[model samples]
Target: MIATPVSSPAYLEYGLDTLFGRITKRAECRIGLEQVENDAFCFAIRVPSPLSDDLEQAKTLVLRVEGRRLQGTVRHSERLEDDSLRLEVEPD
Candidate 1:
């Protein structure tokens, strides 16, 4: 999948793997592609923490952008002031 910058709200599906071995649900989140690279991109999404536990680094994760299928590992995750989660994805 091509990594391109999107100005408007780009819809992406985040499939995060849980540590508790619960069912992985496709949680829809609005994200902005901060920077796009050859095979990776930086994004910030205000995802609710309750949706999933802290995504482990290098953990396999699923991303769907405009129906464009892409897989990546969790490079980083930060908790926002609003108790939301922010993620940096490393696409594979």
Candidate 2:
């Protein structure tokens, strides 16, 4: 995917992959990309933390996982205290 300065909310779909060579179907996720660093970008995502931990037949543990099918809206953008950019993204 081409990463650039996002002017509008972008919607995308991403595949979920595990470390054990397992792949799950694509899921819907929303994201708002905001210009933060000179070369890096801060993506505000709306995927909440998992509320349950049941590793059984189809349960999974997520850690630093990437998502797709993202849809978001840019509310505002500003500089952070750490000299980084902070973009307020609300899920649409």
Using TM-score as the measure, which candidate wins? 1
Please provide, for model 1 over 1-92, each residue's C-alpha lDDT reduced to its tens digit, 9 standing for 90 to 100: 33344322334434544577643444455443444334335443335544444342325556655655556656777777866666666766
| Per-model TM against the reference | 0.49, 0.27
The alpha-carbon lDDT assigned to residue 44 of candidate 1 equals: 36
Per-residue lDDT of candidate 2, residues 1-92 (tens digit): 23333233333332233677644333323222433334233244232222112111122212122433433444444444543333444444
In order, candidate lDDTs are: 0.50, 0.33
lDDT of 1: 0.50
* lDDT at 20, model 2: 73
Error of 1 at 63 (Å): 1.5
Worst 10 residues of 2 by lDDT: 51-60
RMSD of each: 5.2, 12.3
Clashing pairs in 1: none
Per the 3 Å backbone cut-off, how many clashing residue pairs does candidate 2 have? 7
In candidate 2, stretches whose alpha carbon ends up further than 4 angstroms from where it belongs are 1-65
